[model samples]
Target: MIPVKILTSEEAERLGLKKPTKKSGFGIKGVGCVVQGKHGGEGKLMEEIILRENGDLELVFMDPEREKELKSRRQFTGYLKQFTKIPEGLK
Candidate 1:
């Protein structure tokens, strides 16, 4: 499982994730699942799995700076790696 990093308010601002935004219907919504947790502790370590509207599962991360660094080091092949596909029963 991928490790999770919960960004602090400062980190969120640095990553541009705290910017104000207008509502848009084209935005995709997903169900977030916590893959790990500690008893009686703030959720500092956990992976978030998002089941998107298109029936694709995604591991969520908040490090846009790291993503940009990685992208600059290599070419992004315009392909998304799907961890799980929707079940036939759900279709």
Candidate 2:
């Protein structure tokens, strides 16, 4: 399973990610998780996985450089599983 890092609201804010909100399709009123992958010798931000109020998962990709490198959305997503941790519940 793909690994992920769950962020606290404060940490999310510190990272400059969009604030979790009930109104947003991606998140509820809680924090989201970060999905990182290896790139160019170090870990790079791949996407943010947010839990919707209805229990659906939302994926938000924030790295433009990785986007350019991968070209297609399918390739980008496939690459994310290469390095990361999946939370227990998600697993």
Global lDDT scores for all candidate models: 0.49, 0.56
Q: Give candidates' CA RMSD values in order.
A: 20.1, 18.0
For 1-91, candidate 1 gives per-residue lDDT tens digits of 9898999998998898885544333244765543333698665423345665555576554234433544586732221244453333222
Best by lDDT: 2
lDDT, candidate 1, residue 64? Answer: 41
Q: For candidate 2, lDDT tens digit of each residue in 1-91?
A: 9799999978888897965565566336444554566565666565566555666554444456645566565675565454344344332
Q: Against the true structure, candidate 2 has what lDDT?
A: 0.56
Worst 10 residues of 2 by lDDT: 82-91
Model 2 segments more than 4 A misplaced: 1-42, 72-91
TM-score result, candidate 1:
0.29
Off by over 4 Å in 1: 1-27, 35-38, 62-91
